[model samples]
Target chain A: MKSIITEPMIPKPFRIHRKLKETHDTYTIELESTNGADGFPFSAGQFNMLYIFGVGEVPISISSDPSMPKMLKHTARSVGTVTKALLNLRRGDILGVRGPFGSHWPVEEAVGNDVVIVAGGIGLAPMRPVLYSFISHRDKYGKIILLYGARTPEDLLYKKELELWRGRFDLEVKVIVDSASGNWRGNVGVVTTLIPRIQFDPLHTVAMICGPEVMMRYTLKELQNCGIKNENIFVSMERNMKCGICLCGHCQFGPKFVCKDGPVFCYDHIKELFGKREI
Target chain B: MNIAILECDHLQILLDVLRKRGYQVIGPTLGEGAIVYSDLNSTANLPIGWTDEQDGGTYRLKKRNDKALFGYTVGPHSWKKYLLPSELRLWKIKRNGVSFQIVTENEATRKFAFVGVRSCDIHAISVQDKVFMNGQYIDQHYTSQRKDTFIVAVNCGKAGGTCFCVSMNTGPKATFGFDLAMTEIIEGKNHYFLVETGTELGAEIFREIPHKQANEKEKCAADDILRKTAEQMGRSMDTSNIKDLFYRNHEHPRWNNVAERCLTCANCTMVCPTCFCTTVEDVTDLMSEHAERWRKLDSCFTMDFSYIHGGSVRASTKSRYRHWITHKLATWIDQFGTSGCVGCGRCITWCPVAIDITEEVHAIRESETVIGKQKTIVKEDIHANTGTLSGRTSFFKRP
Candidate 1:
């Protein structure tokens, strides 16, 4: 029998170490454990429930590298009440940290295969961990490619990191925008439009995706058209979650609870209900 | 285990014994024009000589010809109101400037002895066990309250107007999960209770009460009441292939029909004995000095239940109804390895619009041929709308 913690609902206090403005509305906040606990070890595509005191909690994906778990981090857009509260946090401001919950991307499983990571808008936050995992274990895979897109040139996240990865000779990083206003001399369209330009052995490739449901749906079709098997593709999902431990039932996606069974799932398993209305 | 027959007048002795054992006895009582479950300090508190008349969107308490303490069926209040609690203080926080320490709640101490629990409700408790107690992440309050709690199960002597435990194969007879199972038999001039001990604790408690060794005739009489209750079931459900039926008929037009009538008031979920969905609330003073987090009962029928940054996923009434019933009967099995419903029929009796779930499922099953034709049309429409990938935003439109 699995022995549960006496109080799973109670969160350990974590103080904000640093905050970075990623976009016009999004911010990434780094945190430190208040009690000097060990590093909060976690994998790619997992999310944490960040509780803003006196307000509420929201589930944000871990954006920092898994290799640097001590510098815990989460990226969120100021969309709702709790997220807006999250954006208002400054250095040393304390908040509650519940998890590093849900299933993670299969980086270990994709060690021998070519890796293709696709992200859109704020969705890049969740995929950043996967890219870091790939870089840390570069010799394990054949080829690594990153295809990221956003609403506009200004909406792209992790601008400095993208440029640094672009300079690397071993990795290929391609960025896109739906509509450009500045002197942008790059591919411009939806993220799926960039998928056709990349080259990887579909028979031995694993495509990882993290984005809004609509973007992921179109991307799935484009990746499948490139001969990538449904089983080889993975996607991260989001829903209204209250208890990140799967008790709240708000994050149910079809037969599975997105909080527990996934925030990351194999495309083949959820293909039937992925794009179905209101599911 | 032991079986005994106690006279009706001596029923007070059972309550007295349980109270002395440090249990807060809770049972059915007449309140708000219905037989509601509440704290029972004495035998007079039980709704004796009272039987409830239940049907779709209706419930009325009527006088019974015989004085049977456990005559009424389940009411709006379920055992969940005590076990899971409508509102629970999960934890409290004391803010000191920019940083604070986590403070856990006091340990739970009150032990409860639930009396007059029906057979179907006994099954409901076991169903919730999978969600709260027997899972990887256990609810702390649930584990504490349920640890040493006692259950007194009563076999139904007659069926309610909306009861269908026989259809779900849950009850009419309390076969297990009870400390004591009793069948109230009111023969001519002889009103006694044939009680059987189900556990060591039950046998110990049974020894403290006034009783006589029940003969074979008395045991057979108890079985006869359960048999009669089973035959008088007011409703029935087809359980075979239920999960597949729901998945195949997700887009069935019957959902729209039910939506037009469903108020989305969440009455069905509130009355359901096994619906365990919840949402949390954070409260604090104006100074933000002290903060508290409370877990409140939530339902899938509400528009806010599925809210995200953009909006509620299941925005339409039809989709909300589809999510609820389908989750209760189909996906819940896939999730928890068993159906969420125990066929208690409280949901049917409490709905304001009288939307019958069994009727809706029957409607879908009666017209399963519509599945192929409807699915094909929707698939064709999606294909036509988006001739190519990335041409359309969403292939699946709002229902």
Candidate 2:
């Protein structure tokens, strides 16, 4: 077998600079450019095919905002074979990155409109870039609200960032836990409960929601009940994507390829597909 | 295109002419209890006076009353078994310290000429071309093998028990995408083959064969034979608004009923001529310096086919089967601009449960009508504006 010398479409063997724990089961790793190569170019919601030498490859969304240059960050949970190997990586280990594949959150379209960010568990990783865009250009939007939920208080991610956003006068941050213990004092319900407590013009709001399939379905239904248009709602879909390109045919939902046509699609565009249990 | 006649006595001369052209001729031969596609050097190697009876996961060989070389409808083997292949080497990887380099190889270069190809198999090859060669990311191996191949298509003289190509608008008669097409007709004490050239290369071959031009009676006989084959089809799928019918019946109970019997054995996809899903596996040698990457055929019916971060998204057999059938019949048109199935009947003939797609679609249509009638009777009492508010509110409000 001969290696065809084509131009590299993705980054290879990027060195990890630091690893930080977001939760007991989750960790965020920061990667630096190897061989003095430029950092991978990617949109916020797009993901990378991270490969370990002997293990395998898995798709992980970029957690760090795109505004940060020369470094890439990914928040991963210890899930399968490839991911378990990724979690064992140290500060100076290397891994392969083959994307920034899939459609990104439409930050430019949400410009000048009230932005509602809803996330559950590790789903917040994909929304991190859009959140940074909002925080950096806070004057360009109307009102900004963030509603996030996790299994427990200790399971919450981005603890420092949540505290910083809570102290800001221009932003609203609401955190929820599915079940609570004695030490917790914040709201103890699902993230959808906080949507009704906040006040915003449904006509002027553009929502970016990422979560489990069941949670996103229920939240979209709740948003429609609040008079939000389907076009104004965006959701991220997770599937078994083998080839980040569209050749493998694993991640097809009806006519669209989740890896190519979307990972982020407007509710109006995919309503019929989402109606069924699986397509 | 020119039509020429090849008398039954001159069949051996035509095979010798093809053999002298430096092309490996492959056709139907007796192998493993049934007729299979294999290399042939002479006319004697062909399955003369032999035919096959095919059903779901069952095939049997029977002797015909007359010595006709091209009388069968189809067999378990299609052209894809040779062209696309079951397994292929994708690339080789070598690790140097912390970095890895991938090497892709070119393995196929031989020229082949396939004889006695059925019309449905030709359609299946055309459908695969849209996927492997016509797309943006071209599969180099498939392109290399298919580029220099010669196809001699044959019109079907009989229909199998599982044949349904007429309903899918694929075939019963060979129309195009072949270098040469022929229809064999046998009468009392006389046999002649009606041949037509589709390309310049086919014309060259026709000139080499000693034959007379086809008359009007021979053309009429060929058409009549094709019409009879179409009429004798064992099954038919309604193509009118089929995509919309499947879309509306996604939640119908018929899917649940079918899932109970589906074993998900994946034989249908394995035998299908156009199913092109593949999975990659990397193996490293004991030295750890050399690694080989292999691409193997994969199917949607497998549990790991839809494996995600947490688990399989399609955990139930019903959802997996629905995904395969709906994608093949409906959504594939939107994806690749053609239906995934060419109506080769391989799926029906190879499935362990004998799950006929035409039967499944009819069941869904009937169940949908029943469900529609039941819903209409309940519509008067149902509140359209503000019904189920409490249930919805409670489900969303739960912690």
Candidate 3:
């Protein structure tokens, strides 16, 4: 028997270029190839398998700008062991990175149409790149709007970037917090309440949403109520993924392998399965 | 050269020939009431004149009137155990200063000769080849084990109660993917093996077996036995546009009915030859100085199989059962360009509750036949009375 060595599961070494805390529990870590290799290119909603030595791996979305291919950025919450190990890393620390996998948000398909960005809490991380693409190419898309909701003021991510994006008159950004604590003056309700305050031509709008399943469900209903066609709405799905490729069968959502077929799927394609429980 | 005939008592010569070539010959042996595949050095280990009666949730061994070897359809054991093993170490990682270096295990060099392999199992192995070998990333372990193995396929002379390879287009006879193909011929007082070489290695091995040319009458008897086996298939599934059948009926009510009966024991996936899902775990000693990542067979029925950070995706047995059946008959064709099930019937016979996949498909198709009239009634009842939360509460109430 001839043994052929294959290491598709092995991760490549990537060094931390910088680390910045987004929220109290979330951190945005910038990474680059340790050997000065070419940077891993990825789309907005696609994810990378971040591997922590002696720990394990987790799928984190590439939250960095797609145009700048030299540096890779991932926003991770200290939710589990692997994410905790990643959060503990200092500058120049080495970790393994595999992929740039799954389907991306249809940013190109949304061109020439008004795009509605709705995100909840840490769910905003995957949508941050899509906002970057729309802001950089300001004229390609029509009235860009973002409606972000958080559990508390402290949970809001990319604070400085949100402030800078708000300064622009071309795009509209609305922020809401679930409950008030210290001089909280914004809207005090779920993300679905903020959808009515924003206005866009729903007929020509492409809505992209990412959040908890229940939150996404309520937000989807609100978007459809605003005359947004089911075909125009896209939602990012979450499932346990072992292999970013379609081999492991862990991330299967019906006929689709969320790791391969999609993390971002159009509403029409998955309308039958969106609110499905235990599936 | 031409087809050869081996007398019933001269089967020991072939075992000796394989052993002389440094091959560990494996064949069916009577063990603890069941015929299982194990090491066979002589014909005494063979389950001669023994046949098995199999049905959904039932199996029994019975002595046959004719003294013919390899008369049974298939046992609980498939050829997958020899190829894609249950557990294997993917790689060993040792902490080297700051970074770790991974050292892959050396390939297993033990050459194997698997005798009495059924045709459905050979097709099942080929289906796995499409998954492990023909894919972009080849499974190194499966590749090495497959390359060194020799197949001696035995054409079925009798079909079990659960045999259904004829419907899946796999076979009751060995069509290809074998080094040597044999048919057990029992006519009156004569019992012999019609051995046909499928490859150069098989031809060379046949030359050393001291066999004589099979005449026309012997060849006719061999073909006649396979013909009878095909006619006696106990179960069959309609594969005509089977992929679309499951796709259109993903939310059919039959899934809930089956889920009520399912225990989620995962016996079906364990016995299925084509269900190749797996998971990896990192194990270390108490001191935690060294860790080894081992890959083991996993079943889709387990809640941990679909678990992500927050919770399991397929938390309900209905969803897991739906995923298993749909993936086997429907979506598997989209992913691998072939059906995941080879209709081996291991799933049917081994399932504790006797949940037959063929029966499930028939139920779905029949439900769909009357779906136009029953659509509004089923939809309203599902939403008004049996919503997911209420339905889940009732599903778990089952004892």
Candidate 2 lDDT, A1-279, residue by residue in tens: 223323223336788899999999899999887877586678879988887765677889998978885789999999888888899999877777777778999888998999888999999999888888888888999899999999899999999999999999999899999998999998898989888988778999999899998889888988888888999999999888776766677888877888878899998999998856766
Which lDDT value does model 2 have at B213?
89
lDDT of 3: 0.85
**Better model by DockQ: candidate 1 vs candidate 3:** 1
lDDT per residue for candidate 1 within A62-132, as digits (tens), equals 99999998999898899988999889989999888888888999999999999999998999999999899
Q: Which ten residues in a row have the lowest lDDT in candidate 3 chain A?
A: A1-10
lDDT string for model 2 (B231-305, tens) is 988778877787888887788676777788899998888878888887766677888777775667889999998
Q: 1 or 2: which has the higher DockQ?
A: 1
**RMSD from true fold, candidate 3:** 5.7
* Residue runs of model 3 more than 4 Å from their true location after superposition: A1-6, A88-93, A201-204, A224-232, B1-3, B8-24, B109-111, B199-208, B368-399
Please provide, for model 1 over B1-399, each residue's C-alpha lDDT reduced to its tens digit, 9 standing for 90 to 100: 578998888878888888889999999999999988899988898998999999999999999988788887889999999988899888889887778766778955688999999989999998888899776688878878988789988889989988999988899999899999888999988999999889999888988888999999999999888899999998888888999999988787788788888999999999999999999999998988888999999999998899998899999999999999999899999988988888889889999988888888887875664444556666886978643334233322222
Instruction: Write model 3 residue lDDT over A111-201, tens digit each, in one string.
Output: 9999999999889999988999998999999999999999998899999999899999998999999987979877778989998898899
Candidate 1 overall Cα lDDT vs. reference? 0.89
Which residue pairs collide in model 1, if any?
none
Better of 1 and 2 by TM-score: 1
lDDT of each: 0.89, 0.82, 0.85
Q: Write the per-residue lDDT of candidate 3 for residues B209-318, one digit (tens) a residue.
A: 77789999999998888899899988989888998888777676778888999999999998899888888777665654556777788999999898877878788999
Looking only at chain B, model 2 earns a TM-score of 0.90
| Candidates ranked, most accurate by TM-score first | 1, 2, 3
